[model samples]
Target: MADRQLRTVLEGGGFFEGPRWHEGTWWVSDFYRHTVSRVAPDGAETVVVEVEQQPSGLGWLPDGSLVVVSMKDHRVLRHADGSVSTYADVTEHCGGHLNDLIVDAQGHVFVGDFGFDLMGGGAAATASLKRIGPDGSVSVAAEELQFPNGAVITPDGGTLVVGETLGNRYTAFDLGADGSLTNRRVWAALGPEVTGTTVDEVLGQLVVAPDGCTLDAEGRIWAADAVGGRVVRVAEGGQIVDEVAAPAGLGVYACMLGGDDGRTLLMCCAPDFYEHNRAPVREAVLVATEVDVPHAGRP
Candidate 1:
């Protein structure tokens, strides 16, 4: 299922979001250009840290330092040797801003938020996923969830999946060797159970809004149907099998699966998911293609 033919590994961003290929290159997060760059697989770019309470997801910490996800001050900065600080504040357990995170392999992060006030329209509550620890401390590793953005951590780390952008679904848990998340379930549901509550009545019963995700090597899950511009690949129970779409007028939201044999899948396009038209536009982009499993967990 490798629908290859979509290159363009970087562009005038302003929206992009937590991608991550690590050590080799690709890390990302731009939300209105508050920076956190690093691309280079021929596209050259490099900025790596400017945050200003904007950068989303991104991980690393097992002494390699990097952390990020300062999404509007809910904190989690770290960056080591180069200096950035605030390794975990959780702003008293967020309820609106912070979004997206994942960092297991003993560093254990797992963040998420946007339980309400989504871009200021308000009314769509329920969110929680916290976990920080590794000496930074912060807890509440799972709760109602509903907008928990993106997350992953498996490769023997004992599962953690997560993507519930407004709750079209992805869920899953049970990782506790100290990170604690416990059984929980529903690792794929892309369609029912939205039950509206504003935000245009739960985005008019979204059919597949599960934004930002990864995890391949057959365990499936590519997800990023953020409004269905497309990415889907899910396979744990709500079977979608494969999908990609999102090149005309763009709108992919997020995706990863890195390169150098990980079967690259990147993608993060834009043109929608408004924060006032992507915070005053630079248009956003970071595409790639080629897929057939090869990336397995944690990011």
Candidate 2:
């Protein structure tokens, strides 16, 4: 059990989410800014594409093409050879915004949506999960999730876990060879008496709405909660053994376990999201941790 209390290593920009570590660099999205950029090891930032609609979720294809979730459009877009194109359009089905995503080792992209207006009064999480093929086709994978956010797969690629934010539950499913889910069951729930967002460092600020979750090779779930402002390490049987604080900020939107050895955690923090201006002061922040746990999954 390893833990640390860290601050934002990099800051400034729009509302940030979807932090993906690829090719020894960190890639994240500024949702409101409509841009997908890469944060280098030296802290240099470069915009890969300024996508249409707000880009929330991001992943890579087997061929190295970039796949993104277009929030406002409620569609999936793929980028290759410096060109952006639509992979799937689901505006009619979702009727809202696509929030975050994770792809499996088999190249299945799992996308989540708000199912309603989260910031402006849509209180419910209206989505099942959607699985997009490598060719950009889409289909419903599972239903009944309330604001599904971040997800991850086991290193063995046998398990799939999703964080249901407003629903206050983390669910796990079996990853089938055909990319279908089986035996969907609750993994953990946000209870009043629970402690520590991380399995280590017992900082007992717990709440409902576990926003984003990632799995370590050590088989731990690092869950980030928007309401709690803490990322918790959930062990087997729903125990929070460690915790990490989100510096001194108003809110913690999402988190990723990346970096050399996978211990470096990057967070998307914002003071507030219910703003009329929509331009965030410091949209995304990058934080590094001493623990080395590589990210496992598609995002």
Candidate 3:
């Protein structure tokens, strides 16, 4: 495939994440701005809601209500009829702040946590992935993950693939009907298993730090290489099938396949991922490029 031309879709975000295509618009979470906004194809934008505790992942319930991850307080919030309320509180189950999430068709939300004080420069530790049922109940879906960030469910809804930023791999789980996760395995090994305890050590061993990602119709994953300045499409067994590089001096943290045709690969770009740098600035941008395959399965 030829290198796709990248174009700016939206700019001036205070560190954007969780890019999603819904109802003919692009929905994204701006970390420093403390708000979720919707962007149209023509570059117009509208703020959806403000998450005072900081918002990360986003998904919709079967009824069309929006559910977002409140990172700081470890809560999942629901937005409907212009009001936001707590949907689930998973603080007891999290070791650190929540990061990203994926909502299944049945409204079962699977969310991941930081596993350590990332911005505080703490050592790396394993964390659990929590599943929030449609009834607002929370439970542990999987455990001992190395900073699980982005996630996706298969088209049949039988499997869940999650990116482990510190582990340099994508892990898979058998998503049970009752919202249970079993049969844990490595979906893709981006690099050798990282056994480092410190953030610096882990960063040194990582070849591709997968962050927020999306699934394609061909069963491949388009994941932001958080430290690589690009988004890579990884097939099963960790082969990089394709990639889209970010502009010089910037890093791509998250991406989603969304557009009128679903082939637009929307990337969240910024100077860096540090809170001190991104939170006080608005250099983050949402850029788009065409891809061969459209999106498929749960977000």
> Of the candidates shown, which would achieve the greatest lDDT relative to the real structure?
3
lDDT scores in order: 0.85, 0.74, 0.93
Q: What is the TM-score of each candidate against the true structure?
A: 0.32, 0.89, 0.98
Superposed model 1: Cα runs more than 4 Å off: 1-19, 24-56, 59-65, 69-73, 79-94, 101-112, 117-164, 167-195, 198-204, 213-222, 225-255, 265-299
Better of 1 and 2 by lDDT: 1
Give the winner by TM-score.
Answer: 3
Q: Which stretches of candidate 2 lie over 4 Å from their true place?
A: 1-7, 123-125, 192-206, 275-280, 292-294
Q: Rank the candidates by lDDT, best first.
A: 3, 1, 2
- Tens digit per residue, CA lDDT, model 1, 1-299: 44658988888998998888987878888888798988988879989689877888888888998988887879989887888888888878787899788888888888888877888898888889899889998988888988888877788999898988877888888897789988899988878888767899998898888888888888888888888787989898888988988789988988898878988889898979778988887988888888866898787
lDDT of 1 at 260: 87
Q: Return model 3's CA RMSD, one decimal.
A: 0.8
Q: Which pairs clash inside model 3?
A: none
Question: What is the C-alpha local distance difference test score of candidate 2?
Answer: 0.74
Candidate RMSDs in Å, in order, are: 18.1, 5.1, 0.8
Give candidate 3 misplaced runs (Cα > 4 Å).
none
Q: How many clashes does the backbone of model 3 have?
A: 0
Q: Give lDDT tens digits, candidate 3, residues 139-252.
A: 888889999899999999999999999998999999888888889999999998798778888899999999999999999999999999999999999999999999888999
Give the per-residue lDDT digits (tens) of candidate 2, residues 1-299.
45575755567766777887888988888876778999886678899999868888888777778889888888888899988998888775683578788877778888888777655554444577898877667889988776678888887778888887766578889999678999998888666433322312122333656776677777878777777776778875678878777767656777778877777877777775554544645455666565556666545
**In lDDT terms, how accurate is model 3?**
0.93
